[model samples]
Target: MTLLSYAKAMNRALADALEADPAVCVFGEDVGAGLAGLTLGLQQRFGAGRVVDVPLSEQAFTSAGIGAALNGMRPVIELQIPSLLFLVFEQLANQAHKFSLMTGGQARVPLTVVVPGSGSRSGWAGQHSDHPYGLFAHVGIKTLAPATPTDAYGLLSSAIRDDDPVVLFAPAGALGVREDVTAPLVPVPIGAARVHRAGSDVTVVAVGHLVHQALAVAEELAGEVSVEVLDPRTLYPLDRAALVESLGRTGRLVVVDDSNRFAGFAAEVLAVAAEECRLLAPPRRVTRPDGAVLPFALALDRALQPAAEQLRDAIRAVLK
Candidate 1:
């Protein structure tokens, strides 16, 4: 048994993947230099031939990953910043994402895009701090936001193995997380929701770093309200069954997501529960204000993010 940090877990996964498959190659800005913490020392471990650093061209390099995948190579592309996803959206959504369907399963793009530090990084402002995971999920791209160090390793391993294009967002807030390893690291299924805490009252569905927040809130409200915390690791192929089962245990739902309220990931969970599950009360979502642009100030940035108190209040409201 060993202890591992989230960033180290990702690094280990990449190292294992590169070692397991000679066809696996990593290409992105500064990966060779290990500027992104997750790719630290990977270039040294694997030769420059496999960990080639590309020029600063998101669209071009993203398209290159698609091209590489179309061939026999498995390419892993790293975007240093989360918002850079927008720059490669056309390449991902139009080209790579469509190839499997457009080619009628004749071609597979086993491209994995890793966003090392996603979500409101303190004072990164509107452009860098944005977490646009919902956009990828909405467009049918396989999107995953891993909350724990173990899930970070497992999900990245799974994403690298999958034939379809996958986007992995490792939340900046959760990057510092460390986990105790009691069992061998293995691949976690893509579309699975993990129940962190079981409760009979309200179910709190959280994404990314918010899972930790929800669990903390659940513990705080242990005396009054029984809160069950659930983490939907994969956003696109949502585990509706697990969520429904959780709802069956607890008749109310509260979603606390780092994204915005309108058309956010939380909204989708609420919509799914409303359509499928029998809720005793209207589902509540604690998320950033509608179309929020996170300010550079610390207080302002923290205010825009969904807090545990907000989740607790939402849980209490739903319980009523």
Candidate 2:
């Protein structure tokens, strides 16, 4: 078995996609230099033509990716920081995302947008640190937030092959995860939920790096309550069936996410339970406080985000 870190798994996925498809190209700031850990050695492996580096303009480079996609080339644009997503939302949400529908299915923008370091990168400050997957999901853009090394490789492979614009947020906190792979890497379907732990007492839905925290909390509460940790790797096009089925067994739900509480992914999950699943008690969520602007101070930053204890409390609250 090979032990692969999350970043290394993504590197393998990009390398395989490049080798398998001539149409796949990666463009971004400092990508040729592999400034981001995930793109390490990609330029040398794929050549300057395919793994081209672009200028500092996020909007221009993002629009260029859309243009490349329109001309039948699949482009993967990497943004070094998550907050840059806000700078090019118009290009992504308005232009690239609407190409297929606007052209009546004649044009397909097979563009994959990658954010290698999403969420609090500790000292990145408020401007550089943010997790806005919910914003993209709100506009119907396909969003993926894989929690493990294996899922990182699989979901990325699937996103690159898809004929639509897909946003992949590799959580800064999840990048350190490593997995011993005894099997070959394969594409994981975009809209699937993985149950990390099976339980009959309560179901805990976690997003991105929060999945690991959820699992740990579940283990801590194993004797008192059986907690099922469900990771919705793909935030949008959510696996509602799996969620409802889990709720059938547990009758209680707790959602954990990094985004702000208001209109966040957590809110959507709770809405799903309210609409379709049978719940024995009110569903609760542990998330960043509403309208949270992460303070620069390390202590203040963590205070604004969700914690393991908060997740446990939320789980217990739901089970009551």
**What is the lDDT of every predicted structure here?**
0.92, 0.93
Relative to the true structure, candidate 1 reaches a TM of: 0.99
lDDT of 2: 0.93
> Residue by residue across 1-320, what tens digits does model 1's lDDT show?
79899999999999999999998999899998887787788888888888989998888888888999999789999999998999999999999999999989999999999999999887999999989999999999999999999999999999999999999999999999999999999999999889989999999998998898888888888999989999999998999999999999999999988988889989899999999988999989899999999999989999888987788789889877
lDDT, candidate 2, 1-320, per-residue tens: 99999999999999999999999999998888888976789899889999988988999989889999999999999999899999999999999999899989999999999999899988777888889999999999999999999999999999999999999999999999999999999999999999999999999999999999999999999999999999999999899999999999999999999998899999999999999977999999899998888888999998888998898788878766
Give the winner by lDDT. 2
Candidate 2 — which residues are off by over 4 angstroms? none
List TM-score per model, in order: 0.99, 0.99
RMSD of each: 0.8, 0.7
